[model samples]
Target: MTVDLERAAPAAPPAPPRRESRIWLVATAVTAVTVLLIVYPLGRTVLGVFGIGADSTVGRIGEVLTSGETWRLALNTVIAVSVGSVVALMIGAVFAWINERTDARMGFAARMLPLMPMFVPSIASAIGWVFLASPKAGVLNGWLRDVGGWFGLEMVEGPLNIYSWPGLIFAYVLFLTPYAYLTISSGLQSLDPALEEASRDAGAGALATFRRITLPSLRPALGASVLVTVTMGVAIFSIPLVIGTPADIDVLPVRIVHMMTHSYPGDIGGALGLSLLVVAAVGGCWLVQRRMLAANAHATITGRSSAEAAVTLGRWKWVARSAMLLFLLLTSVLPLAGLVLVSLQGFWSAEVRWGHLTFDNYRYLVDNELVWAGLRNSLVLAVVCASVAMAVGVLVTLVLARRRGRVASTVDAIVKVPSTLTHIVVALSFIVAFAGPPFDLAGTYLLLAMAYVVLYVPQATFYATAAYHQVGPQLSEASAVSGAGDGTTVRRILLPLMAPGLIAGWSLVFVLMTGDITASSMLAGTHTPVVGFVILDMWTAAGYPKLAALGVLMTLVSSAVVLLVMTLRDKLLVVR
Candidate 1:
């Protein structure tokens, strides 16, 4: 008995000491780095709002609170977000209903088409819409004129002029409808067909069944979609920056950027102060969403391996197919095809001459120093930044899942701070915090990487946390009790088990960082010229062809990366 006790005791001290310390060390490092990057910048920005600390402004917080323009801007933001969210929800639900209910051959394409905007950078989308809808030199108008002339009718000369609130609404609908579609599609796929069947069997009509059964069952997903779309609509910078700035339309995110960039003497303090207000509002919305979703049960009809059932549309199948096709054409095929055609054509102002087709655009992109440099910089930044972000996410997930202490909870909360704030506010805070510090990390790859990490950590944590929850803690504990040290246990057990979630997290971060425009714009001062900024510059410079090519390249690269990740995840993570 003494000998057995001695052997077990020896295992206890050495095993727990090394393994526990290592886990804590990793957790601390991840938390500390995240705090420095996200927390510090956020703190500085909040302080700047009250005119506290260095570079204090003369204005009081009360004055800002009382400002009429503040309220007006807030109202404007709410209106745009509300309208955009509703429109996107309707479009997404309609398409998702079609994809799930009908036996459409193009359902695959319907799903794939919304994915185009995900590839094309946001600015490129704006540019494509502008070219198609511009009042003076729009291709649509030109085509309309030429077709009308054939009938000897008086042709219109001016452009279509998509430049105001309605124009911005049109653009937001184009981009945000995809989010609605994806979420609603997932919901539609997961819904139990039995409920609808029962409703119909009880003498309910199709529309009645949908209203009484299908819609209510999908309330959670629809709510989540609305909250997400509204949040994005409120924080949208690129759409307004490209279209609204030219039109002199002021929205909240645009106003925030303008404050930072255009304010006299570059009032970083004032900009950050305003940013805090935006952050507070957005944070409130996030908290509200959490509360609403907290109690809702999200039970799916199928497990990971089970394919979702297709609902029979019966007589309305063709109508459903047509709706999905129309959405595909409007959102994906038409815009993307327009981009390719316009890029190939020599001029937007003139009629397309097939003979004018040349490799000049591709050659120009290859030759331009800024374009090449930006591309190279974007790749390196995305690779390095996404790697660090994923690593941080792993640690974050482990701490949130395995550790139950107060310290772990605190760390978890801190990691979520960046997600609540707008990128402009975060940018302002970094400018204030690092401009004159011993730990100043401005204008370096380190700074950009940190920014990307903070920008994406919330999404990574959200997905990873869900994944970790799906993977029970019993496996890790059993491994530990069976003499597996923490490192060995994680390697042999937890990571393999949680591999799907990790891959999903990684894919999400890659897609987000690859196309990130807002934070990258504010953070990539000089050392980093990310793809987003390059798109911005090209659009500004009227290098439409180069921008289009660059946008195409970004879309292709991101999609390939996501696909590869998904494939690897399936092979490794799915428990056979």
Candidate 2:
């Protein structure tokens, strides 16, 4: 009398062997492309370094490893990164704790603090600092000199030099702080408040409870933040190029750049050597963090609301608020004011002649052939690369989400390969890989675009994965039942639902590419001038006003593009 529903239901046919084979072949092809894109550049460089034609190059590796200059490079790099990471972590963690837990929150403004670097290019920020803190012409120095005059402490030069070690480290910290804040703040939001309440019930003070419970719980965040800060500091070229180069405080990235660009015959050998060292260091940190994460360095309770009563700071609340304001001023207000004033000054000078300020620099931006070309190239490159990368990311994410087994595993591993490398290292590898021989793509938009896609694919994939997971699978299943194939379902249902996220990912890459200097520094040339290259050219020509104006223009253009993408996404979603 059993219903036997399983037997009564019609059996679904298994996937055909030819279709399955085609799927495998497609996955293999995708894997091959991913490997070629991510690995070929770096592998080509290393192979060239050790090949027969590279006898001198291989020998130079030993020379570089054994020399006093190399030691100074390593030592200086370590000191800068170590100090910068700690200071950045402290400032960022303090900001996160205050904003997330204390009564000093500033609502939406506080949330935007971590996104400081996205639009405000680090190169622009560093140049602004140079104009603000240069020994002779720094505006801040001028103000200090005027202040010191009242106290009769007269001096012609600075008590502050942005060309010094402090200056270099300060520049690094400014960029790194936001990274630390983001990770730590996310950790703070995820922690369970019940544990802290228990600690309070046990008669522990706020500080004591935090030390015992919160700090230990946040080790994962702290460790990840430090890793990011140190790696980024090591790979940073702008601070070192703008500040360290003049100060004679050489770091690895600047050293790499010098070997490639400063000499008539570029020291390709030496640059490759340093790049490998950076790769090793970054790879080691990534591996260590991965293991730590796997081993459960810390754990947090999830699926509960993170809203908790703000801890009263008593009279200290005002101090916390003041700290937030100071952060805002340092990271945003002062740097922006410096750029604005310098652009108006027409030349680099301490005294801002309000009446003499002109719009000639702005005019130059509009009129100059090379500058205008560079701006246009950067914009086009950003848009095109973002579109292509998002397309690839979505395709890869779909494969991983919908399929299973060895192919998926291979694809996942291949996609994450770029995450272990620093951008400048990857940029250098691209130069070595394609600047000669069969592939001679150097100085072309295709070359820069390929390098950008490689450098940012990991990020794109991560964002795409998040987007895929956000939508339910039931929608796709329903569409299949209603006779939609994979392509039709993706085109009609998935794309619309995924538009906002995909566009957001696009905006991130667009912003980065439009203002990018690391890759552009190595790969961009006269034929394929980009905003970053022009900015560097301005630096060399002593055209401070034009430099500032161009930087401001680049930032504004990037912001506009991001806003436009978002607007289009909204309209498209509404239309669909």
Candidate 3:
């Protein structure tokens, strides 16, 4: 008995060192990756901004500061973002109030329908809007002109120019409203109904009750939604590129693209400088938002509150439902239908003739070898990036969960840094860092995949962390007591428990990567084709029919993949 006890004690001492070794190995590996992917690229870009001599970095910064075009582009970006954010806030607030607070018709459908617009890629939405409302050959504009002519008014050829500032703002609002709705609606749903009921019992009118109680209760959520919408407005690339370029309107993002691609010898230095400014502006906004959230931490809902009682709209309910339906029509159904219609037409024109329609666009896409290659590239990039991100996310979560030192905290902060930067900025950094020297990986699918991984790893880590928190440490402790190694415990216990979260993170990253435009446009070359790049090329060449057809194909493929992943996730949860 004494000999056996001594042998078991020796076994326990070795187990701890083995576990410590594995933890150190994983933490070091994750830190190295973060440095390579995030730190090195960003550092290189910042350093490149301070070159020497006639091509001096200081001179470039001075030139950018002195240039009127730079200020003009900045002004245009601010105006568009401000206008779009305001419109989105109003629309989103109303929709959330109606869906969550009021007794509106088809309450469930009203809430679900808004999410449809989210699934349609912003690039696709831009293409669809162009078809429906372009100044020259817009179907709706032409129809409006005809209707006005019947009243003896000589209407303009096409009055709804989708290429103008108003048009751009409209598109931005449509895309951003869903975010506002989701955020505000979540806040409204969580509010304790007793306060609102108490106000009503005191003879307060509906508007008064809302102003004094409901709106104040949702202030934090409203602030957050506003920050998100405005930040997105500034960072958005696809909408501005598609709509602003045709109208000769240049926002900062489009200007960055032009500088990097169109200028003689390419003004890469100027582009990087501009990107730094944008990042600073976005960072400032994020800081302000965080401060606001921290300052306003009052709890409106107690844990004892039951299901929220919906406000009865009475005769106004029909009007509310009509308004909701109209929003859905303008933002979702119309754009989608316009894309389908334009895909069938020989050319985008006001007049629709069945005889002029053909399947040639679809055939062209199907028969083109280049298009096939692009499709394959897109699929492979999405799958590989998502899978790799998930794997990395697991390692990151483990390191974060086990360690609490300053080094661990610093690593956490560095991992989250990329999430705050826009996609365009991240892509520009990659170009400046990896396009030359020891890593001449520009214009390659490998570089493109790396960009996707960097952009999305933070998101996957977020999901994984949440999932990890759901699992208790007791299981791991029990496994350790049973003499299982760290690797064995993770494989047998943690992984099986965290499978659902891993799958969810994978699906989200997959969908985001597949629909991504900014990185694809910035990184892809003739040899490394992607769907977003293909669509942009087609749009520039005025191949509207082919662009629409490609948009439709991408939508279908991404939607199917999302559905499959969701189904798999559901099955995994059920098994667990």
| Candidate 2 wrong stretches, greater than 4 Å | 1-32, 49-56, 294-299, 567-576
User: If candidate 2 were superposed on the true structure by all CA atoms, what would the RMSD be?
Assistant: 3.6
Using alpha carbons, what is the TM-score of model 1? 0.84
Question: In lDDT terms, how accurate is model 3?
Answer: 0.81
lDDT of all predictions: 0.70, 0.79, 0.81
Q: Write the per-residue lDDT of candidate 2 for residues 109-153, one digit (tens) a residue.
A: 776665656567788888888888999999898888889989999
Ranking by TM-score: 2, 3, 1
Q: What is the lDDT of candidate 2?
A: 0.79
Top lDDT prediction, candidate number: 3
Give the per-residue lDDT of model 3 (tens digit) for 120-217: 78888888888889886887887888888899977666778999989998998998898788788878777887788788989999899999998877
Q: For model 2, name the residue pairs that clash.
A: none
lDDT of model 2 at position 569: 83
Off by over 4 Å in 3: 1-18, 21-24, 50-56, 99-111, 146-156, 185-220, 299-306, 315-324, 470-502, 573-576
Better of 1 and 3 by TM-score: 3
Q: Candidate 1: what lDDT? A: 0.70
Q: Which pairs in model 1 have colliding backbones?
A: 135-159, 135-160, 135-161, 136-159
TM-score of each: 0.84, 0.90, 0.87
All candidates: CA RMSD in angstroms? 5.1, 3.6, 5.1
Compared with the true structure, model 2 gives a TM-score of 0.90
